[model samples]
Target: GAGVSQSPSNKVTEKGKDVELRCDPISGHTALYWYRQRLGQGLEFLIYFQGNSAPDKSGLPSDRFSAERTGESVSTLTIQRTQQEDSAVYLCASSLSPVQPQHFGDGTRLSIL
Candidate 1:
């Protein structure tokens, strides 16, 4: 029924600040993934969680990025000490797995000021 959704469709923050973005995946989906699409840049995988624990987090750009999911449901991405380079659309998607086509949310557009 319900598709994935992200909060604060747009966010503007100063550099060096901390920001948290939220995502709500479809019901019954067991896998959640986060990705970043920077301006004119290709999509970059951030992290993914299956069930309630994360098994792959290598895509995190640095210590400033972190995320968590609760039992294949809601997820949140947190950025510590935000930087201008981090400004982009943070997208969340969910599916059976990487091989399955994922449904994507409009994403929370973060702009560093």
Candidate 2:
């Protein structure tokens, strides 16, 4: 693939709802990352996956946030009991390795009412 791909580019939900955001990294990429960007704020690293090894999920802000990736392909980020503060852009990026530059996909815009 030419770049990372995210589905349902926009999402709207009420408080307490749960949402799932999906990411498909570029083929052959071995490293994937998830980030959150609140309105007018900088990106915050959320999770990272490298190959089939254990993912680095320490950056997840709460127990409600989780992510999983299989191999070097698709990954899904799930948020439980969504709140107004949870509204933000969820970004996905992929790189050849941990030290390499990453290519990002258009983020999933989440809105909570």
Candidate 3:
């Protein structure tokens, strides 16, 4: 697809388990972002990556959440010791630059048991 892509449309894991979500942004995009959307809530920004380096990660809810990108292509969001509250839809987005309009992916639904 020409738009951002996310893997494992649905993921089910037990509480305290670790999970990894993947994202592939549109080619040539230099800015990538990760967001989490819980039931009835808006998208909560998680991290932002310009190229391969993350410049803003203040939106991460806890230390258990971390994300990294490789070059301007794929990125991965890892959650360690996942908890019940961590269940949500993980969304990925990308733009030509930080100031450009973002294109989003079909989010990954995470269900913690």
Using TM-score as the measure, which candidate wins? 2
What is the per-residue lDDT of model 2 for residues 8-36, given as tens digits with 9 covering 90 to 100?
79999999999999999999999999999
Over 4 Å off, model 1: 97-99
**Candidate 2 regions with alpha-carbon error over 4 angstroms:** none
Any residue pairs clashing in model 3, and if so which?
none
**lDDT for position 77 in model 2:** 99
lDDT of each: 0.90, 0.95, 0.94
The reply for model 3, stretches above 4 Å from the true place, is none
Instruction: Compute each candidate's TM-score over C-alphas.
Output: 0.93, 0.97, 0.96
Please, what are the lDDT tens digits per residue for candidate 3 over residues 1-113? 58899998999999999999999999999999999999999999999999756459999999999988888889999999999999999999999998999999999999999
**Candidate rank order under lDDT:** 2, 3, 1
For candidate 3, the 10 contiguous residues with the lowest summed lDDT are: 46-55
lDDT, candidate 2, equals: 0.95
lDDT of 2 at 88: 97
